[model samples]
Target: MSVNPTPLKPSQIPQEAFDWYDAYAHGAMDRRTFMKKLGTLVAVGYSMTALTSALLPNYALAEQVSFNDPEIIASYEEFASPDGHGKGRGYLVKPTKEIAAFPAVLVIHENRGLNPYVKDVARRLAKAGYLAFAPDALFPVGGYPGNDDAGRALQRELDREKIQQDFVAAARHLKAHALSTGKLGAVGFCFGGYMVNYLAAIDSDLLDAGVPFYGTPAAESLRKNIKAPLLVQLGELDERVNASWPEYEQDLKRYKVDYQMHMYKNAHHGFHNDSTSRYDQANADLAWERTLAFFAKHLT
Candidate 1:
């Protein structure tokens, strides 16, 4: 008989740690307060290093992700956003293997501008057979400051309307790329998820579909204008985001929109990022598989 090993449960960390992380990811808290708050997780039989290392490996382990996938072509590129708010810079990735006009996806980051994790996400999308472009919202003001606090501060300074223009331009650039088919799609998290809804609503002719993870819902006014299908992923433990789902679903139904949504049980916001222990691998894997299937059906 084969034996199944028990799942690893992070017992030492407190739920409060995840709350602090949520606050940080959404730009609602500064690093000093976040760290001071998250530090409490170590009080229950865990060392500060051990628990921090587990909850947030990205802050430290990011350098190790020189994801040199031989099958992927990945690099940074700048594209024109003349009609947009300003020029855009993004981490671009595509499969090196011959592809006749591959489907393209715009990978949007969390509140923090284009960071290493989002770049890696672009590479993963490429490995999965789609062209992925992740734009940095702070490109006009230099770029993403390497530090978290600086990135969050820069995030607040952004003009919401102008930022939308940048994303519209970025998606257009991806769909228009020499190697891309006319089909265009997007996947965004948190801040980016909200962007996906906004962009899809306004550019019904351009955006084909969207997958938004823990992003705030589209307003009722915007729902009527949405042109693409939406695959929404929510974390059951995230009260701030979950509160909008009931009304959002009603709006989707009222508008007769094509959409699908799932709330991962016992999961918190940002569950898909493996760089953190907060990631629920089982749920994230299922969500990712479903997301890929959804994209293949709509984008391809």
Candidate 2:
């Protein structure tokens, strides 16, 4: 009979010290130099990647998986109004393993449209045991202008009424889905984030929690109509929106709405989108943790 290998024990090694020997063995460092430098840092107790991975295997796996995993099934459902003028909408839906009715989240993509990044976010939410739906906000513009410059140009030409109708249709469709627990929340990035805020202002039935990352504020009249709690994320280094965040907070306070506003230092717009140059891993991770907690508090 073959013998199974013995599992490593944390007590066998110092947790705080970087494992230079392991690094060298894994090819992250050369053997001779790592051995020479290892002794110098042993006394100070430095943390190492190997040590952390060994201690928390789950953390390592979480970091390795992209927020949007393509393998996760995202069934697209299309809808159009009776007038034939409304642009059909597509939503990314991922179910959870939990048997009981679980809370659902609607994820809105940035100006890039309902691309891979948005799908990845939905997958992450599903992995966390929540039903996630990512709707294409740009369906009115022929779906994601493909390039940033062109997308913005198309955004300028979009009709607000058309987009609003699309959102409404998408919401109705998702609310009726079997996976939805009737407790719902919304999250959006960049342009999508702004639209989430807009939806909150208008729709009072389905929204329990809202998270808008670096999105623009809605009109004061609309803000007063929002019935859900909000957790808004902003980036201090994002010149485009950081300066205006104070005004947005003031509006939220003016309406006496339950809200939490966070500004990540040294981060920029699109920090949640890893495909973009403005992505900020630290801030995105923090935002995601907070978002899940918020949904759990309000929806669960």
Candidate 3:
């Protein structure tokens, strides 16, 4: 009879492993390199599968708000991106309760594309009474392959500039939709967080509010162009992303941008993501509570 190895707790995983997974998740490192590095853990009686299971996202855990929820309606919609990949599609969700018009929010996904977690995020937003749209940057390349590893590999092949344009186009489409009240907010994670920063930087009037979780800050030169209210969320241990915050914060202050930042103690990169081991529930809940309040104060 074959025996299964014990499942490792998130606390058992070393911080180095989490950092390596973050790099691998963002396409900064390839799978072979990531696996080789994890081999060190395997040598210590941990099975390869055990280490991966501890680090990788289990999408099954992502559906906090189900697609069939009676309170919201969800579907995929396409929009034109003349300057981008020419076209794009997004998962759009809206509350079922009737209203003359609803405030809209653009939810952006990480480098791994529009995985289940992001879709569920849109649903959660809708449940809160905001129309939410999450565009798939990987759509132009064939969309998310149902697995993050494949999704990340596919996303790395697309043109970065065009992808930015696609997101901009999606924002415009959501704002202009007949059901929209013309108010728009944006929230993103990792690469998506970077996009939220980029969108706010390039088109000051485009977003009414912006929330970026553990995303890279925009170039200092572009900081002067930002006009939207921003709520920046960072993890205390995310050295790679936090390194740029000091200079970015200085520039935001110099320009007098409306923004606030929260650094969760002892949290690591991707801490807001509940589907992975890096998730920090206490911090994530507090950050999200602040995010919803921030959007309500500005968008409503």
Candidate 4:
């Protein structure tokens, strides 16, 4: 139940930790390399196991909800992508009793496709009464391999535009589902977060709201085209993602797109994902609460 490295004030963290996190997140450093680099922190008091444990999600944390949870109705469902992209499948989560038409939310994963963590995210959404669909970007290639690294490998090989189409198609299907009220929203992390920007930029008629967590902004030219309201969340310590924010804010303001941005202090990249050490539970929880409120305001 302990968070690895234990929670520390941002000022108390060592420089090596930030280096390792940046390298690992950018793929310049693999798990092994990250561990080797992080070893330095062990000398400073944290155990090697604790350090590693804090960064990657253990099985238990990766899935906080179960399929048999009293109100959960979960299953696999397929949707058609664009002609060339063919079809895709996603883990669908909904409430067991559907009293009326419910707004749907599309959960987009990071570079690793839809893994257990993302599935748990969808289930959490279902608990809030939304029909949640988490589409696997690896689907057209055979779906998530059940391993994060394996899924990342598959995700890297995808046709960029076609992958975008797959998401668009999934949104279309979710919006058309029998129990849907026709209002659709999206929440994406990392790569998926960037996709949220793309979705807002391109799918004006279908997507009504977007919440992109630490994602790259859509191209400036596309900013003016966005019709949905956006709630952008970022970690103050995430340099790579932060680098783009200044210019992105100018575009958002210049374009007049309805949007709100929040940057959490003392947080690094991927702060909202509880499966990793970067999980700033306090900040993550607040961001999530706001996200749900934002989605409710627009989707309902």
The best candidate by lDDT is 3
RMSD to the true structure for each prediction, in A, is 5.0, 12.6, 1.2, 3.1
lDDT of 4 by residue, 1-300 (tens): 965455454345575687576677667788788877787788778677755555555546766678789987999999887543889999999888748778999999998778888899999999888999999989888888887777777877888788888998898899999878899999999898999999898767878999999999887777778888999999988888989999988988887889999999978888888776677889999999999999999998
Query: Each prediction's Cα lDDT score?
Result: 0.81, 0.67, 0.91, 0.85
Per-residue accuracy of model 1 over 1-300 as CA lDDT, tens digit each: 955433334444577777777776676776788777756654554466655566654654333335687888888888888766558999988888876778999999887788777787788888889988999998888889886557878878888778788988898889899988978889998888888877777767878889999888755677788869999998888888888888888888887889999999988888887767777889988998988999999998
Worst 10 residues of 3 by lDDT: 2-11
- In Å, residue 148's CA in model 2 sits off its true spot by 4.0
Per-residue lDDT of 177 in model 4:
95
Q: Once superposed on the true structure, which residue ranges of model 1 sit more than 4 Å away at CA? A: 1-11, 36-46, 57-67
- Judged by TM-score relative to the true structure, which candidate is superior, 2 or 4? 4
Give per-model TM-scores: 0.89, 0.71, 0.97, 0.90
For residues 109-138, could you state the per-residue lDDT of candidate 3 as single tens digits?
999899999998999999999999999999
